[model samples]
Target chain A: MIELQNVAMSYGGGDLFSEISLKLAPGSFHFLTGPSGAGKTTLLKLCYAELMPSAGHVSFMGRDVRTMGRDDIAALRGRIGVVHQDCQFLDHLSVAENVALPLTVARRPLDARELMELLGWVGLKAQADALPPQLSGGERQRAALARAVIMSPDVLLADEPTGNLDWDMSLRLLTLLVELNRMGKTVLIATHDLNLIRAAKQQVSARVLRIANRRLQLAGADL
Target chain B: MRAVLALIRADGRGVDRVVPPTGHTAWLTVLSAAAMAFLAVFALALALATGRLADRWSDALARSATIRISAPVDQMPTQTRAVLEVLATTPGIADYRALDEDEMRALLDPWFGPDLPVETLPLPQLIALTETAEGVDGEGLRLRLAAEAPGAVLDDHTRWRRPLVSAAERLRFLGLISLVLIGGATAGMITLAAQAALAANGQVIRVLRLVGARDSYIARAFVRRFTLRGLSGAALGTVLGMIAVALLPEADAAGGFLTGLGFEGAGWLWPMMIPPMAAAVAFAATRAAALRMLRGIR
Candidate 1:
C-alpha cells in the first residue's frame, strides 16, 4: 500500500500544485484524473518513489520512501509494476522480451507457457517476436499492460496507459485492469477520460481522486 | 521494462550479471588490445636489453686499471718489470696481471688485424690491476710510478666507463617509462570507447531502468563487453609482437650496436605479461567509465 500524508509537491512554490494527502489502501482500485500538467504523472511518480514529495512524507509498503536506499527502492519497485503512457520499451527487444522484463530484472525463472498464456490474454502472442517500434498504438498499450501485470504485483500504477489507444483498445486495457483487481491486486490509474472512468464504474467499484486547488479530493459522482 | 524484470528475476537476490550475452561481439576491442600488447613486448624488450647492457657495461669496467710504461723503446721491458714489481707491493691492489704476447696482440685485433706481430712491436708494456673494495687512489699510484718509474702513466678507465654505464641505465629507465605511457594511453582509449558505447546504448539503458534494472546491472553489460575485448585484443598483439621480435636476426658481439635490440635468455617472459596487464587496464578503465556514465543519468 502507498500512503501520502500532508504531501506537498511544487515547482518554484506556486507554479503547479502542492499540499496533498492520500492513501492507497491494499487491494483497492482508484483513478487519478486531472488536466494536463495538473501533477498527475508527478503524483504517480511519488507513489512509486521515483520522485520525492518535495514536502511532507510519502510511504511505500510501510517504509518512508524518501529514506529508502536506492537498492531498497529498486526492490520495492520490482513488486509494483508501472505502465507508462508512452509504453516505454527497449525497441531492440521483441514484444515477449519487453513484456517479460519485470520478471527478468527480478531474476525470477519464467515459465514460457505461462508467459505465452499472458501474451494470449493481451492478444499479442502473434506479435511476440515483433519489436516495440513495429507495434500499433493499441498493440503497444495492451503490451504495456501485459508487462505491468506480469509480476503478479501486489500493486499496479499506470499513468495514462490507454492515452494512445482507441476506445475499443482502451476498453480492452481497462478490462484487463478490472480482471487484475478481481484477482486482488491494488490498481491506481492516472487518466483524464471521464467516460473511461464512468465505463470502469460499471465493471468495478473504484474510487476516483482529483487534483485541484493544490490538494487531492474524492470526485464522487463527478463525470 | 520487461527486460529489466527478466534480468532481475533471472537470478535470485537481484545480483548483476557480469558477463554479457554471447552475441554481444567486440572484435574491435580485441584487435586494439592485441596491437597495443604487441608493441608493448618490444618496449619491454628494449627496457630489459638496456638493463642488461648497463649491468654488463658496469661489471666489465669496474675495478679495472691499466698501467702504460712509456719508457724509451729499448727500456720498455725494464720499466714494465719495475711497474709490476711496485704494483705487487701496493696495499690496495687486489690482483695484477701482465698480458702475454698473444693476449696483448689479441686486444688490438679489432684495430691492427689478426696478422699483427705483437712480440715484434715496441708497444708500451701494459699491466692490468684490480683494486680492493676501497679502490686505490689513481693519483697516488701515479705519483709513486712517477718517482720510481717516471714514464709510467696509470689510466683508471673512469671517465668513459662511468658515462657509458649511466647512459645505458638511462636508456633502461626510458623503456620502462614508455611501457607505462603505453598502458596509460590504452586505458584512456578504452575509456572513451566505453563512453561512446554507453551513449549509443542510452535508450537501452532507459528501457532497462524502466523495467527495474539497477544501475550496476546495466553497467555490467557494458563493462563485461569491453573487458573481454581488451583482453583478447591485447593477447593477439602480444603474441604477434613476440613473433616479430623472434624473427629479428640474432645479436652479434659487434660492440653494442644493432644486436642490442632483442631479449636475451629468460628476458622473453617479460613481454608475456603485457596482455593480462592490458586486460586489467581495460577492466579498470571500462568499469570507471561505465560507472561515471551511469551516475550521470541519476
Candidate 2:
C-alpha cells in the first residue's frame, strides 16, 4: 500500500500540484484522470519513489520514502510494478527477453516454459525473438504489461498504458489489468480516456479521481 | 582481496549482459591499457638495471685507490719504492703492488691502442692499493706520501665514483617516477572511458533501475567488463615488451650502458605483475564512475 499526505511537487518555482492526500489500499482499483501536463505522471513517479516530494511525506508499505536508503528503495521497487506510457524497453533485446527483465534483474531463475506461456497469453509468442523496434505499437504495450506483471507484484502503477493502442487492443489490455486486479493486486492507472473508464466501471467497482484546478476531487456520478 | 574474488566469481553470472555493448569506449580502454602497460614494462626494466649498475660501481670502487708516481725517468724507481714503503706502514692498507710495465700497458690499451712505446714515452709508474674493511684515511695517507714521496699522488677515486653513483641512483628514481605517472595516466583514461559508456547507456540504466536493479548490481556490469579488457590488453603488452627486451643486442665490451638495459636473473618475473595491476586500476576507475553516474539518475 502507498500513502501520500499533504504532498506537493514543484519545478523551478512553478507549482504543479499542492496539498494532495491519497491512499491506495490493498486489492483496490482506481483511475486518475486529468488534462495533459496536470502532474499525473509526476504523481505516479512520486508513488514509486522515483522522485521525492518537495514538501510532504510519501510512504510505501508503512516506511517513509525519504527515510529509505538507495538499496532499500530498490528492494521496495520489487514489490511494485510500473508501466510507462512509452513502454521503455531496451531496444537491443528481444521481446521475450525484455518481458523477463524484471526477473533477470532480481537474479531470480526464469522457467522457459513459464515465460513462453506468459508471452503466449499476451499474444506475443510468435514475436518472442523480435526486438522492440520491430514490434508494433500495440505489441509493445502488451509486452510492457507482461513485463510489469511478471514478478506478480503486490501493486501495479501504469501511466497511459493503452494510449497508442486501438480499441480492441485497449480492451484486451484492460481485460488483462482487470484480471490482475481480480487476482488481488492493487492497480492504479492514469489516463484521460473517458470511454475506457466507462467501460472499466461496468466490470469492477473502480473509483475515479480527477485532477482539476490543482486539486484532486473524487469524480461525481458524471461519468 | 574481496574485490578480486568478487570479480572472479561474477565472471559468468551474466551480470554484464544487461548493458548494451559499447563500441568506441571498449577499444579505448583496451588500447590505453596496452599502451600504458608497455611503457610501464620499459620503466620497470630501466629502474632495475640502474639499481644493479649503481651497486656494481659502488662495490668495485669503494675499497680501492690508485697511486701514480710522475717523476724524472731515473727517480721513478726511488719514488715507487718510497710510496710502497709508506703504504706497507699504513694500518688500513690491506695490500699494495707496484704495476709492472706490461700490466700498465694493458690498463691503457683501450684508450692508447695496443702497440704503444711504453718504455720510451716516459710514462708515470702506477701502484694499485687495496684497503681493509676499515679503509685508509685519505688525508692522513696523502700527508704521509707527500712527505716521503712528493711525486706520489694518492687517488681514492672518490671524485670519479661519487658522481657516477649519484647519477645512477637518480636515474633509478626517475624510472620509478615514470612508472607512477604511467599508472596515473592509465587510471585517468579508464575513468573517462567509463564515464562515456555510462552516459551513452542512460536509457539502459533507467530501465534497469525501473525494474529494481541496485546500483551495485549495475556497477558490477561495467566493472567486470572493463577489468577483463584491461587484464587482457596489459597481458599482451607485457609479453610483447618482454620479447622486445630479450631481442635487444646483448651486453658486450663495446656496448656499455645501452645494451645492458634489460632484466637479469629473477628480474624477469617483475613485468608479469603489470597485467594484474592494470586490472585493479581499471576495476577501481570504472566502479567509481558507474556509482557516481547512478547517483545522479534517480
Give the Å shift of residue A76 in candidate 2: 1.4
Q: Which stretches in model 2 have alpha-carbon errors above 4 Å?
A: none
Error of 1 at A214 (Å): 4.1
lDDT of 2 by residue, B1-298 (tens): 4685569566545677778998988987888888898899999999999999899889889999999999998898899999999998999989899998899889889999999878778888889999999989999999999999999999999999999999999999999999999889999999999999999999999999988889988988888888888888898889888988888778774568978889999999999999989998899999999999999977
lDDT of 1 by residue, A16-58 (tens): 5566888888889999998888899999888877777778898
lDDT of 2 by residue, A1-223 (tens): 9999999999999889988899999999999999999999999999999999998899998899999988888888889999999999999889999999999888899999999999998999999999999999999999998899899899999999889989899999999899999999999999999889999999888999988887788988976
lDDT of 1 by residue, B150-201 (tens): 7888998888998989998898899899999899989988887787777777
**Top lDDT: which candidate number?**
2
Q: Which number leads on TM-score?
A: 2
